[model samples]
Target: MRRSIAVCTLALVTAVGCGKTEPTTPAAPASGSTSAAKPMHPAAATAMQFLQASAAGDLSKATGLLTPVAVEQLNKQGMTIAPLNVESPKFIMTRFLVTEENEAAVEFAMQFQIEGEQQEFHGCCVMKNIGADWRLAGVIIDPGNGMEPVVQNYEQELSPPTTNPANTVANPAGGQVPQTAQSPDVPQQR
Candidate 1:
């Protein structure tokens, strides 16, 4: 009797398991149909595409995204315009300012490791819309130290004028001290 009960339980479990069906995956879209993907902004799309091509070591495709002036500048600098041999290349968008309806300025930072040493590079690209396509108008690469002097000069230019020699006061030693150096609240000792 016990053996018959055990066989009956085993048969019931097998029957229940066999009644279940596997889940099916959704079918892929047709080859030419990209209707499911979201579209990107023209400037951002072009810039990202250029960076991806460069990272993939496709020099021709990358250069094709640049404007004629940019290509000429690269040639003038004697640069090979090839993909940099970097490990773990990262592109970061810092700013995207639209100056006009069809013009924009894009600032980005790139970080990567070369020869095991990590480095960061900053650049700004001007993009212009030509017909329905966005293309690079110009590119400026910074060595990370180029803006210091410019900022310093601008600050100096904006600062108020320094002590004028015409407002000098004679000290005990008959030396002239600019009025700015002495506090007006304190009387000078003759």
Candidate 2:
């Protein structure tokens, strides 16, 4: 599980890190500024709204923007819609595109001050079509510090292996536990 999470986090970081960001410039006066901020895509906007609601601890509003599966996943994970441990959180969208016929992926970087220290983390939210609306289906955030990936929302279903452990050898040192090798294709359990 740790390896898989690391690979996924690396992939997302690479993808978002590869994008070219514009250099910041001094803002013009509101009355004189002609260029308005570009509007977010409808699906991305929904994602942003969900993030905001979640950070604000607005459970009803946050859950309203999530799929039933996501809600159930959060319940299983013992996670609640609560305020984060950071202050002045700012979100910067890195990518927003349709990933499939009825799915969209929104990649973002969240910057905030944690105990007077500035920190940033990256994550992605997947939105799926539900009739005429798009709802959050999955969310994965890497909060660094070697912490476990925060899979706060739904993704693929998880189930225990149906059979006993495979590919193990007895320890030569008379240890009771057998030594086992992990396959790259298999995700390890926490």
Candidate 3:
């Protein structure tokens, strides 16, 4: 009887032990998944949002993401940004440099198709942490196509000077006939 009781007790202990549950952590969501809308970094999220907004032709949304200085610079340059027809925009976060506790530079690569043309651009976005939010301070894009921002070439000749009769200065000779044409201004040396 004692042996049976001991066996039952062992069985109960084994059953209880077998029925015990172990703690588990949920798996992390895949990157870029909407259901898990968490981004790897704040600047990355901002950049991606800006690109998406621009691609969707949401100028208001896109401009809203830019810093005040960026908007002013764009305005100063008279830039007319056409809506991009981007497909499958991918953002790859690269090196991130923290200049200070509140400022950081995020480098990233963007790949997408614009008007059916495949395009890739590398750029950096300077971000400033503002009261628990990350704001884009500036953006620099390098298309890596040996192209640069269009600049007015002041060295290039504009146009031939227009002949303005009203602005023309009077001849210093003051209506005097040229020496070759008539008598010299001063007596010619014999």
Top candidate, metric lDDT: 2
Show where candidate 1 strays beyond 4 Å: 1-40, 68-82, 145-190
The sequence of per-residue lDDT tens digits that candidate 2 reaches over residues 53-159 is 66766778988888777677667867656556454566666666564566666766777776788887777776777788889876778777777666643544544
The residue ranges of model 3 lying beyond 4 angstroms of the native Cα positions read 1-38, 68-82, 114-118, 149-190
What TM-score, to 2 decimals, does candidate 2 have? 0.60
Clashes of each: 0, 1, 0
Best by TM-score: 2
Span of ten consecutive residues with least summed lDDT in model 2: 24-33
| Tens-digit lDDT string for candidate 3 (89-108) | 76655555555566555555
**Each prediction's Cα lDDT score?**
0.52, 0.62, 0.51
Lowest summed-lDDT stretch of 10 residues in model 3? 149-158
Better of 1 and 2 by lDDT: 2
For residues 12-68, could you state the per-residue lDDT of candidate 1 as single tens digits? 233212122112222222122233534445675576566656776878887787766
By lDDT, highest first, what's the ranking?
2, 1, 3
The C-alpha local distance difference test score for the whole of candidate 1 amounts to 0.52
Residue 22 lDDT in candidate 3: 21
